[model samples]
Target: MHSKTASSSLSTSSRIVLPNDTNVLGNLMGGQLLNWMDITSAIAAHRHCGRVVVTAAVNNVSFNHPIALGDIVTIEAKVTRAFTSSMEVFMDVYVEHRLTGEKKKCNEAIYTFVAVDQNGKSIDVPELIPESEEEKSRYDAALRRRQLSLILAGRMNANEATELKALFEQ
Candidate 1:
């Protein structure tokens, strides 16, 4: 398959936080935000490979700030790296102030997805090319994260994790 640029698979979704989506503290529920993020990230993965994708893992979700009810939340997701059949997607969650219209980044998340065929078997995905500096950084870091995940899952030995090993060697 041909390579695709990260920007090409960019997926964005925006929605207002309603009463049903919030907690007793009037803040948007984390699970609700995660659901939105999964859909957006899957869209990005599908756009990159043109096949149905499934969420394999949810990683690195950082809740830096609370999003109050009535705020507009925008989720932007893009493919950071692609392996044989899996892709690492990164998302930025921003909250727009209902009153001032100001936007601030409130959270970030990383998700892993695997492309599948109609029969539900794993399928190959195209390679991802990152252009911008931030994309490049995230793309490079994806390898290290993958290595760590594999090690923790007992699928990879520490000695075989060259990318992650290099980080500690430095």
Candidate 2:
């Protein structure tokens, strides 16, 4: 397969926080938001690979602010990088006030997905080309994040993580 631009894999989802999606404090529940992000990010990964994709890891999530009930939540996800068979998707969550219509980013998440065949076996995916500054930044960071994750998972020795070592060498 040929390389794909990160922008070509962009995906978005919008939802209004409902009673079922909130906690007793009337704030949107983290689990509900996570579910939405998973679906949205999966779509982005699939778009990048043009194949079935499965979640391999939830690399990062930041619940920066609590979203109030009835707020309109929008999630924008895009593939940041692609490896042999996996792609990393980055997402930003924004909440719009129900009354004032004000919108602000409240959350961010990074997810990794593996492209799969009909039998669910991992398959190769096209390389990713990040055009925008933000996409390029995320693309570079994805390698560091992957190295950190590998270290944490005991899949790689800490000394072997060149990207992570750069952070401490400075």
Candidate 3:
């Protein structure tokens, strides 16, 4: 079966950050940022899988700058790696000043998704189509992230670790 591919820049999903999405300090809440990240990342996953995809894991999520209310929030997401029925997506969020239009990098994260069948079980995803050198670099990094994930999960063997090290060195 053929699967459709989709890609979008952070600006494409820009929305004004509202007070409700912010904290008492008038900055966007981390939780709210995460919610948007998950949603946007899922959009990329579904496009790659052509089916329902669930958040299996979020490896690294951190906010570097605060986004204030009235600022434009942009979240860019893309499928960087895929294996069997799972995909690893990388998302970066930015905030643009409402008046000046200057943008600042606010947050970045990596999420793992598993394509599911009607029964909610894992299913195979489509082949990824990397469009540029940067995209391919991100894909390779995601694979390294997956390897580290295995080590963290106590699933990595000595041979696997050696192979992963070699691949990452390239």
Task: Give one digit per residue, the lDDT tens place, for model 1 in 2-76.
Answer: 999999999999999999999999999999999999999999999999999999888679888989999999999
Candidate 2, residues 1-170: lDDT per residue as tens digits?
79999999999999999999999999999999999999999999999999999998898998889999999999999999999998999999899999999999887899999999999999999999989899899999999998887788788999899988999999
C-alpha positional error of residue 122 in candidate 1 after TM-score superposition, expressed in Å: 1.1
lDDT (Cα) of model 3: 0.80
Q: What is the C-alpha local distance difference test score of candidate 2?
A: 0.93
2 or 3, greater by lDDT: 2
- Residue pairs clashing in model 1 are none
Model 2 segments more than 4 A misplaced: none
- Model 3, position 123, has a per-residue lDDT of 90
lDDT of 3 by residue, 87-137 (tens): 888887888998999998877789898999889999988777666787778
Pitting candidate 1 against candidate 3, the one with the higher lDDT is: 1
Candidate 2 structure, TM-score to reference: 0.97
Measured by TM-score, how close is model 1 to the native structure? 0.96
User: Runs in model 1 with CA error above 4 Å?
Assistant: none
